[model samples]
Target: MQFRSIAMAIGMTALIGATLLAPVTAAEDVPPAPLPSQSLAPLVEKTAPSVVNIFAQKVIRNRSATRYLDGSAFWRLFRDTLLFGYGQDRFESSLGSGVIVAANGVVVTNYHVIEAASGILVALPGGQVYSARVLVSDQRTDLAVLQIEAGGAALPSIAFGDSDRLKAGDRVIAIGNPFGLGQTVTSGIVSATARTSFGVGDFRFFIQTDAAINPGNSGGALIAMDGTLVGINTAIFSTSGGSQGLGFAIPSNMARVMVDGAVKGQTLVRPWIGLSSRTVVPQIAELLGLSSLHGVLVTDVFKGGPADSAGLQPGDVILAIDEFPVDDPQALRYRIATRAAGSTVQLTLERDGEFHKIAVSLQLPPNEPARNESWMPNLSPLRGARVASLSPAFADEIGADSGISGVVVLEVRIGAGAYRLGLREGDIIRDIDGRPVRTVDDLLTFRTTPFKSSRITLERAGSVLTATRN
Candidate 1:
């Protein structure tokens, strides 16, 4: 009995030990692994559903033949039917990419894509094609929405990621129809953000990436790793018509604004204060008693534009707009574009060593009647005023001061902010709040959305006119 009892105790102890150590053994098997910094697989898989191949065609009166505008016998006879094809010419056939934004077939693409398209065809990921109709386009934002007629057809859509939340070095994936190769995926990191000169549509803030974006990738999806759409692939920094690891996309934040406005045929009227601008330069700064050359310098103010109507003037330095800080021209543009027209905006600016607050309500750009010309200017950047540097001889002829150097106001758009400032052909813009203007690039770099009000100090006919757009 004693021997049997001892054997039973030993067996019970052994069983208890095994039970206690079993949990520990399982825990040791996993051991901890380092967290992953990035992944493109999820981005490609999830975002690809929203990207669609876009093909558009429009019947346009072919303008292949030339006719003199002087209206000669040959010109008048052929102008209507021969030079410009009367009815039979098919003027457009183009390919691009688009992202499905709605489960009911609402799609988003670059404005230029379907601006002139008489017919639009959208191809789904599984190789299904459907007809589309353009809802509306905001030229200022370069954003357009299309409506597909597949009511009962289940469509894959994308969710908008906060582009404002993206940072440099974040991993991103681009899926598009590059060179019309159907659906293609490329990977890269956000190299930079908010570059202005890419000129994709009318938007300014951008997510710059090293992704391999090529032609036909316009309006494609640029997404974060978790499949959130951060941007729309639009333009590339290529010299040879191929990807050079430098591409730009429209941030999804702006895309959302445009897409929302385009829904159900609503118009997107971007807020405008109405003024022409040039960048403040070292010379302009010194001439105007400014310590630093920063912010957009108002070169001209419209006579009745928001700036002119509100007492904002020429030569005022605009430092910030709507509480968003700005130092570059592009920054101002980003701030303005992110707002709706007729919205009230405030600026903080310095004038004569004192800061001022200017409140102004924005206006929509004036409408232009449709022209018969082929919609080829859909992507052109010279959509605004024509400008060049002012000549000393011209200044002297206009009785303007010789030291006031700036580009000439050769043309004032009828409804532009500058034209409303009573800006005519002869005004010599001397300085922008202690800064100087000299070149077109200087003007391009000039930003006004940051300032509370724009001030312009120009010399005209021996009198210095300081106009303020408040």
Candidate 2:
């Protein structure tokens, strides 16, 4: 019996060996299925060439140096010899990234990237470099478009994706020159959408991502899995100026507007919805009888404006814009801003426990008075100040009460008497020397015919203060 058991074991071992040595089938020769991965390799390969490193150079004035002789040739020679003239003018350079969005080498980046740059150099992959010119920039949205002569080279361009379709947990990739390092890519998931309260831009609805965005990542491309541009990586919320897993990107929808405007050689004239609103908190939503706490509470609507003309009530809760959910006022602004002027949009709102859809025609923002500003260099209490006639749009843009109309101080130079006396930019001159002042001319008249160091009552950021030059 023992001999028989040993014979069976030997036979079993031989059978296993024969099975292992047998010719593998074509299916067996095929590699095992790849492990599931969040790899962005394929997407990066398709999009990385479109990302470029931007080096901007600017000359800035240095004010800390002592003047040997004010405005004299002798002082200039002495200063140049002693300080190498570095104190008078200092050269500054900024580093950022941009993405080519057109085959003709049209690039898009953050406005701050080339805000004051006198010269811009774009370095593409494979070491090719080219000079870039600013096509257009919109500071309100912090977006800039650049045009580069590619010397007949067909540049790779990135396509814009639907940022409005993004949701939390969606994978994203950020490609840029982090810390001046040439072209690095980082991956993370979208943490939130329509995020507001950043206090950075005028219309602030940003896409929050956990991608490792650092200093030089500004103006870089945030790409979706389909190899499309979802947003422009802009700012990071970091205490150490490094990646803390909190990054913000301007939505591609907004960036698209700037690019379209750049192509048309015109500024993006966004249609205004003419409404001021606040995000609906859970308590507010509950009190309003909303099925879910996911909407914006309209606080005020401009009279004779689009919302008013559409019969929108002040207490209405804006649920969505053409099926896109509106969770905050910023979201509503973003939706309207992205649409063209004269285009009609449907606003889904909840009013008095009933949901209603209203159609509103987008209109150009109110024609505020031109800031054709005049400087007051020789006038007291107004010296070193730039004043403009404040209109509804200007006041609204500056976060002032739209009903308040007066000559608003645009700037007050440091060390000026006005600055010393608590006068500042955005200070609306309610009255000067107890005289009612409503325009820049009124303030100029008051300053020219000054009677006893001007006494001024100004409204600044909702607070009224009396400033006396005497």
lDDT per residue for candidate 2 within 250-270, as digits (tens), equals 999998988887888886566
Q: What is the TM-score of each candidate against the true structure?
A: 0.64, 0.77
The model with the greatest TM-score is 2
Model 1: per-residue lDDT, tens digit, 151-223?
A: 6787999988888778899988899999877799998899987676675554366789998999999989998
Which ten residues in a row are the worst by lDDT in model 1?
A: 369-378
User: What is every candidate's alpha-carbon RMSD to the true fold?
Assistant: 12.9, 6.4
Tell me the deviation in Å of residue 185 in model 1. Answer: 1.6
Clashes of each: 43, 0
